[model samples]
Target chain A: MADPAYRAAGEGALRIEPLGELAAIFDRRSQQTHLVTQPMPEILAALAAGPCDATTLAARLADSFDLDGEGDAAAILAERLDELAAMGLVEPV
Target chain B: MSTIRTLVDLLAGRRDAAALAPREWDGVIAVARAEALLATLAHRLSGAALPQPVAQLLGDARAAAAVATAQAMWEAEMARRALGPAGVHFVLLKGAAYAAADLPCAPGRQIGDLDILVARDALPAAEAALLAAGWEWVKEDAYDDAYYRDHMHELPPLIHKLRDRMIDVHHTIIPPTARPNPDAASMLDRAIMLPNGYRVLHPFDRMIHCAAHLFADGDLAGGLRNLWDFHCLTRDFQARGDCDSGTPDGALGYDEWLGDMGYRAKLWGLGPAVRRALHLSAALFGDEADYRRLSLGDRLFRARLLARDDWGRETRPLLRLAFYIRSHWLRMPPLMLARHLWTKWRKGRGAAR
Candidate 1:
């Protein structure tokens, strides 16, 4: 199967503010604020730059932060993208 | 750079931090803070190489503004949720709208209060919804409350009991009696809806509303910030070619928009206020002829706006009072003004006792 391409739901509509370990994202589209920790913001930032599939996103994430080698990074990124999509933060492009 | 000139230049996006002396930073910051433009100043000066202390001060201000803006967004959401069930879709106004829409004038802007507009008929339902959701009338005096309902454009300001944030729910840009009774329905119909389902005034309506509010409604105490809003919004619209486009069907052109909003006479005062504050007029009013014709009112507004001393104290108290009287005069007829001032004076004396 082709890798699923993912994009942020409201690209320009989200305003992100980092608060220590957590980040606050205000979606102007939904008018709802979501607080997320770690790789979620990193993931969103990546998608914000441009749309990318899970394999490409995992490679992008690996370039920035240390990832555990025990698990497949592509699988981990795909799971994270699923969570983000459910939260209305991202969608399949 | 001269401190006032530097401040104006910075706001106009013509960066020249190299020429500023260390001693002048304190005065410039003081003036900007007093005018509630510190956040805007911080926003403009961001990323430009500056003295360490100046950069740090602006950084801190910008951080604080970001937090406030987030809180404002949350508050707006709460308002929408509370009012939406009652079929009330409120129109966000001023700073809140700017921030919500992510307009150019929004970054680093400080919102003092949340202002919204609803159809006059929906006001009662809107107020009830807010009150039921913990918003309380900020004014306790019966006469003041009555005055707001009977004569003003908005309800007495309300405060969230738990959040302690104030919200002004207005029905029209100006009081019906004060201006030519602008077509509130037309404005509401033409509002631009944001992705969040909230709406803001159309760009043209927004500009005229700011002009009217600054020049016709109040005593110009915070006129500088308001005029900057006028300048930025108008310029943005012009740059986008929105102003140059032919008038939308059933909508007024720029000149007619001003007149319909009851800013025709006040624009005379506002024109000079903008020119004096920013030292630029061509971009704002299109031509110098319109501004030149309004020089007399411009002088009055300019004196009032620029009267503050180094410490931000009004240097020309009499001129300020004259402007204050002028604002009241513009708001009501002579007889009503006399009665209103008398009542306010009596209330002040009673409170002193």
Candidate 2:
């Protein structure tokens, strides 16, 4: 038998909205708190471009971060998307 | 956030010492908030003397794992005793068994009421024994009690007089009104007894029981949750190498087993819900689906068969009339029509007093 508290989370469907701003804020939350001198401009550029899917935006932002893996970029992007979705930023659409 | 982050670590089996970068922090926070709410409920109910944080985490983890450990422990203990004296035979059903089987440490989904099965002939004795064990008969009108006992598989649920736990004693595997007498009792005859003398439903019977419960239970209300249970149980059953082939005589054959369940889920516009359940369960416990008739793509099929087939001669005319209006838009079956008319006539005559 499922307890009510556990069941509530399963039923609570996250909704999407405010297409652009939500994405930007989540994208920031996806990264670190300390704004490094160099990567900040690139993140800003990516967010400034308006609402974009993770794949394309992550690709654009890759040059700013010295990382070897696509997984790292994807992971960061996915976390941002989750944060955005939780905040009612981007939706399933 | 710390709670959720810790939960993720626990779930991932990462206990040593780990540092969370800024990026992982928010996800951790969201998970923690969700975990906290669930943990709070568990702590309140478990009655276990543990550290507050530890109890909360176990509760939270149980919630995420979708299995009720605390409730299950209580029910299993009660069930052991309830069926012990009668020797009438009983088996732990659903979450209780699933938890016992160690499917997952998390409490399985919703734990509204404990469900158990007893011998049909032993129902009276079983009811008495349950009452003796501190369960109070739910105080419903006699008509409702009679309605449930005669028509439904289980009684109106017995709440523990002391602990406030709810128990559902079932004599049949499915609702009697569904499909003009579903074969619930027949399944019990084939139930395999545990080494400890308790009975566990035969694998095939168990699987079919789940399907029947989801299909025939009225209201189509908990469609999503029921489907999720079906999906998880199916996957779990399959993964344990407890396939239809290994099941004794009446078990579902591989194709039929998967096909029937898959088809039913797809037909009911429940594909998305099923998919979500499948994905979530699989992610947690690696259960796979085998497609038989319907491809994964054709998900919008109508599952009105269960609700449609037994409209007449089953449910009360009032409820049946609602079903009739929704589907056929006209009431038929002259005998039922006559019965309704006669009942109404009697009611009116009595009212004249």
Candidate 3:
């Protein structure tokens, strides 16, 4: 089987409010306001573009933002994807 | 003026933050926090002139309340989703209801638990649905659970295992054993369904429920915040000429509205409580047009409602104890109250030991 793909929740379900350096995501499903810093919001925004596997998502992030530690970037991103999944913000596709 | 009074005055818009010493401001802020009315005061006095520190505190209060509102609404949503498909009808009650309808009392209002009123017959299904949705019993003691089931208006409180949020599923607004029994069936009959699939009580019923919660069911602890909710809700009605969805055409006065043969017959056996609530509101918020001379009992009630010292500590211990007993008295018969307290004391001792 190919690598598992994850998708961020649709626009209507999650409301993103910028809080200075961080962002507050009011998830309507969980009724939780998640205060997330950089890379998390950026990852969610990237996922919002479309569902993708970890490697593809890492490349998408790399194309625009200059990511730290380019060699293990996908590995770092897969961990973050797991975190978002646990938060119910992202789901396996 | 007393700090509690000053706080209420500020909250009610009868007084502004004009010419206040920093120490006095500190006292007022303390009292407001004690009453859980800080965010409300912040919202009410948002545009008024204020000290820089006080303004910053109020701004923080507003932010905290926003988070609270979101949590409370989310809890309500979860409850609805849990109970909806089971064909159980529940109208949101208290602060959750206000938040759902986005009423005047919604903004900056501190919410505790999700209170939803279901029909007496829907109790079993509602409880089962909630349990299946990961809600466990909050009351473990057999006696308290039995008391809740046998005498109280609601189920033994349920706390979700995952969310750690509590929900009170009520078949009526007040306890069945209480003297004043507001018609839950009729109130539910008059409930309006919002676009979001949540239901709210009619405007008048909402005020009546608030008044009952303050006087009949509770000991007037944190009564100031409850009274402020009553004030905001009533003022919103009076501002809009009392032409709520309940009264499509402009009604005459609250008296006529309550005395309406149709309403009185179907609901509102608890009209006196609403009357007292309005009289107290008028007296406190400076609505002289509707104010009445408060009876001695009413005066004591007001005193209890405003029972706060300068440092935000609760004052009037004797009065507090009396009202606490009175609340229990109102909940059940005298003998039952005594027995219940005895059992509770024994249970508490057993647990401590």
Best by TM-score: 3
**Model 3: how far residue A61 lies from native, Å:** 18
RMSD to true structure for each model, in Å: 9.8, 24.6, 6.1
Scored by lDDT, model 3 comes in at 0.82
**Which is the winner by lDDT between candidate 1 and candidate 3?**
3
Worst 10 residues of 1 chain B by lDDT: B280-289
**lDDT of each residue in A1-93, candidate 2, tens digit only:** 211110001111222123332322222211112212333234445644554555665776776666568767756665655443332223322
- In Å, residue A90's CA in model 1 sits off its true spot by 20
B162-187: candidate 3 lDDT, tens digit per residue: 77989999999999888887888988
Assign candidate 3 its CAPRI class. Answer: incorrect
Sort order, lDDT high to low: 3, 1, 2
Expressed as tens digits, the lDDT of each residue in B95-196 for candidate 2 is 565544444322434545778887677888888888866788777657557657765678778887655678888877555544324344655676665544
Give fnat for candidates 1, 2 and onward, in order.
0.00, 0.00, 0.31
What lDDT does each candidate get?
0.74, 0.48, 0.82
Interface RMSD (C-alpha) of each candidate? 6.6, 18.8, 4.1
